[model samples]
Target: MHDFLVDLLICPKCYGELDWQIEQRSLNHIEKGEARCQVCHTSYPVQDGIGYFLLPDSGREDLWQEVDSHLVQHLQQNPEIEKRLMGVPLETLSPADQFFRAMVHEEREEFELAEESQSVANSGIYTDAYLSCWQSQTKYLMDRLASNDKPLIDLASGRGYLVEKLAQNHDFPIVATDFSPKVMRRNRRWFEYLGISDRVSLLAFDATKMPFKDASLEIMTSNLGLPNIKGPSELLHELRRVLAGRFMSITHFYPVDDNQNRELLRQANLETMLVRDLASAAFEQSGLQVEFTNICLSLAEPTPVGVVLEGAGIDALPVAETNLEWCLLEAQQSSKAKH
Candidate 1:
């Protein structure tokens, strides 16, 4: 991580200022160090150029872990399956199979191949409208990102798709944050391979309790990350506390009348983060004025989870097929914002 980042950070656990002691540095990047909070005495480590700032008691569920674990075990037991699958042309594979193929590419550090596999899988699965809007949304973020020279932190930067695009397309510093250390490590290698490591840094931190100093950040962005955060009741408040500028997020909402998916979203207790009106209200309750803009509706069908072995497909959540309204969330401090 950059030395400049130390000034922007505080202890996420206690919000106390930290004392950074660097043990190793490569010019501007600190590859090894410990950032200890002066008040609470919580020591966070900087490893492999990514700062580990997650809370000790973080109870977040990692869907990636499940997939990786099952895939690893499946490949070990059925050794020939990997060769058989890899030998097939990517075009002939099902979207579900393509998804697993991408996983394999990722393991081998074949970044471009993994992305190619993902593109094929996504094209086969999601509706045309879904792909169009996703492309447009990414383009929109890339355009907006060019205006700011200051650093940007992409929250919940799983798999690093949005962040990669931003880094490649824009001329701004980016700090990609996720709760998963494994994801961060993967991103470090991937970004290095892409030759964009200098412009990007990695941090493993929970979004609800960010490591940023209070009101110190000018901009924060996320691509479809908001609704996935656990315990968002306090999250909005926490975001407002730390942001002096704005938080721009790309999110999609399922129709409340879409009985199958709507009930599923509500049961997950993510109504405030998904439903447009509910999201706005929740932001206002947290003392941030919010607006939903650039809205577009798209239809999405369920994507089949492919098997690594017989009957052991990656069982991921939210397989609901339905229509969705994609939009950008603009949230900033309100004049009426209460401390």
Candidate 2:
């Protein structure tokens, strides 16, 4: 467990700080310790290294018993299959390992996509057009925030497409960051291509743990990134923690389907304003006060049925022209909150 996670724990009876004691030699069993509240004289027992802060007679035992049964069943499953399927070393796996594995898988897929795009760029076929498309998209977003004069932070800023575009029009410093080093190198190339290598700084940073002081940045934005994140709430909290002026995130807004996604939004508790109700709910969510929201419709020819079927490997029918709706959201972070 992280040292910061200790902030989440408190005495259940007296709501005071309970001393963390390591009873066993193993780190996994360190939670097994008797906790006595200094204020209320209430003692909580530790069973199997899990501290039960609730009273012994409390009705919460049924919930904990169900959780314990589920864990036992999970442990009974095949270790090798669990390792291959979940990318976890089942024997040493803890709750933190499970969360980290999920994030690793998500990042692996994103890196694969970035590699494919780089391959296409190196093919020398439509390279100019591909780069132009990225440049245009970046410009479109930057133009909307023309009035803001603060430094910009691009979260999950793969290849620095947005950063380079902003550099072309504005002189403000740009911090381009991504979890993958491959993407950060791509971003460096973008700066070199734009002749603004000195203006943009690239860093490998996890969005959940932003490396910035509180209220250090004026603007924060992410394009086609947040949806791929597993810990959206943590990312949002970090964004709010570092942003000094405004926070903006552009993402593919899919409807909540599972408990994980539901819990993510619940933890963030962000005040969201949707631009336009698209078929797929493509909208931007901002923690700041939304000043404007607009929708832009673009038309493109659909992919061929054979290519679609081969790529997705699911279903194929017919190809037709379709309209795609993109949302543009602008908001300002309130100065009142230091979060």
Candidate 3:
């Protein structure tokens, strides 16, 4: 929404430069406006201080709006939760607490089910062992990330958990990009409420073809989002096009080569090598090198999905290489190399 963001934006349809048609403004941010492409003549809108660079055919807007309304009502019902989130910003609550509170407010029904399922799964040793591994890996990643001040774009930032954490802990500006208008609207409201809006901006766009120009961005991140993308290679290729530094992501990785893991993947209609191979190929195509890969989430017990499937007599559940830690990558043409 900032005036300077115009420099980084391009026509999603044709990747051409755009001319702004401002209808409203708030200080330095554009409250409402339209961006017309210089080449293709395509027009994208800026609403609620967030820019929408999505294509004409993008779905999920209405569903997400409904989700946002439910989330807001959920927050309103819980006085303690609302107070913690709206009060004192960073000093009032821990990042984990804030994250949990937000999750409860945003996905109360799902969170309750997950907790119940986790209780059932925690009776097994798998869950404990997984948590231990996940903790160690995440600690290392947070340590490294704490020292990084590079401008970052967190793609597929559902509900802005990482964005909230980063905005609270770091001094640099962060861009939270997603495909859902309602999600972005909620993100904007949450950031503003937390007093971190000054450090964050919400953007609505497709991951396969981001609005950012070639080599304009330093870092890109997608957590638990790679699996949802149908064509990750194309998304990676797009990441390579815009990222001048690196693309870091954390996603579920199944051990397809293992018999048990292979069976689990089969039940889910997934291939173990799908994300790994796609990311590797995409990194190579984008002229990026794989920097680090960590085990971010070690599943000590069955996941909610796994528990349900197992309860239904499906013995094979996804277990191996469950959640990867912050896998850091570096672009070959990076302008700013991290120390």
What number of clashing residue pairs does each candidate have, in the order they appear?
A: 0, 0, 8
- Using all chains and alpha carbons, the TM-scores for the candidates as numbered come to 0.93, 0.46, 0.70
Cα lDDT of model 3 by residue, 16-135, tens digit: 999999999887678888999999888888888889898877665652344435435745786665665535343344433333343444344344433433333333324565545544
RMSD of each: 2.7, 14.8, 8.1
lDDT of each: 0.82, 0.47, 0.63
Off by over 4 Å in 1: 59-68, 307-320
In terms of lDDT, the poorest run of 10 residues in model 2 is 308-317
Q: Which structure among the candidates has the greatest TM-score?
A: 1
lDDT of 2 by residue, 85-153 (tens): 354243333323333333333333444433333343232322343334434556667776787776577
- List pairs with backbone clashes in candidate 3: 126-300, 126-301, 127-300, 127-301, 128-300, 130-298, 130-300, 296-325
**Winner by lDDT between candidate 3 and candidate 2:** 3
Q: Which digits, one per residue and each the tens of the lDDT, describe model 1 over residues 1-339?
A: 877899999999989999989999987888999999999999898988989998878864442242354665677677798765677899877777887888888877888899899888888767799989888888876776677888888888988888889888887788899998888888999999889898888999988888888898888889988887887777887898889897999888878777777677778887888787788888888899988777888888766655433443542334577778888888899988744
Off by over 4 Å in 2: 1-137, 145-148, 252-292, 299-324, 334-339
lDDT, candidate 3, equals 0.63
